[model samples]
Target: MENILIPLMDNELSPRFDLAPEVLIISITRETSAMGTLSERVINFETPSAEAMYRLVMAENIQTIICAGMEKEVYEFLKRKGIKVLDNVCGPVDPILEAYLAGHLSSGQNYF
Candidate 1:
């Protein structure tokens, strides 16, 4: 079982991390092959802080993050907590999640 988080801009991925106005979360299980939606939340920030986002990820028990252009400090912090951050992923939210479910999502790449 794993929970994945994406910083979203409309239905597409945000162009950059730490600047997304909203977020989408998915809950997935290896045995069941379903992309279950856990929640979607607005990032409450005039300027979204990486630290604030990290706290939300931790609180949500997010195992993986599919996002674009994350800062090194934030990336390292998530890794230190054993969370997988797939940075630089670009495209529509649905296809990206689908690619992940099919096991081919990657950082700095488009897998659709």
Candidate 2:
């Protein structure tokens, strides 16, 4: 399975309480040794539109999305397209994803 993990600026990854300026979209390919790879770098150019973000994810062939927060419309669209969405995950991406794969991450309160 391939999954994307984004690190937020607060809650664990950093002391600041704001989403990272740039969203890091990672593609994790589960294989013999759990290969973690970076597919692309998505830079939100002054509040990018939901459609643009969605398109970027599609272009990178991401199956799952992990982020701090997302608009409801975008989330719904991704869900309809068969993409799993995980929200309220604030911390360093790699460790958070590792926790998720190990079944230690849980869906927290909804913020969108």
Candidate 3:
């Protein structure tokens, strides 16, 4: 299974990374043909810095993260950790997640 995390704000993608407090955590099997059997949970935390968020993700063994914006340095830091960080994604969280599971989400997508 691949663990995914999406920073959220009132059910939409958070306007910015640092501002996101509640993150929707999802676990989907590696076979990403469709929305696989998903198990989801919520984790509320401040700061999106690689230093802090890194620990949380590591703890959960997260494989991917879909978020709005992030510092280039932090992005690189996570990438180096072997975690896929999809940045510059904007839209309501549900549609975003659906599109992602459907295998079409990419950086700089604005489904607003």
Worst window of 10 by summed lDDT in candidate 2:
10-19
lDDT (Cα, tens digit) per residue for candidate 2, span 1-101: 57463534432332221234445665555556755453545444355455556666777677776776766776788789898777666656567766766
Worst window of 10 by summed lDDT in candidate 3: 29-38
Question: Who is ahead in TM-score, 1 or 3?
Answer: 3
- Candidate 3, which segments miss by more than 4 Å at Cα? 30-35, 46-50
Could you tell me how far off, in angstroms, the CA of residue 95 lies in candidate 1 after the best superposition? 1.0
Q: Which residue pairs collide, candidate 1?
A: none
TM-score of each: 0.81, 0.63, 0.86
Local error of candidate 2 at residue 70 (angstroms): 1.7
RMSD of 3: 2.3
Determine the backbone clash count of candidate 3. Answer: 0
Off by over 4 Å in 2: 5-20, 33-47, 109-112
RMSD after CA superposition, every candidate:
2.9, 5.2, 2.3
Ranked candidates, highest TM-score first? 3, 1, 2
lDDT: which is higher, 2 or 3?
3
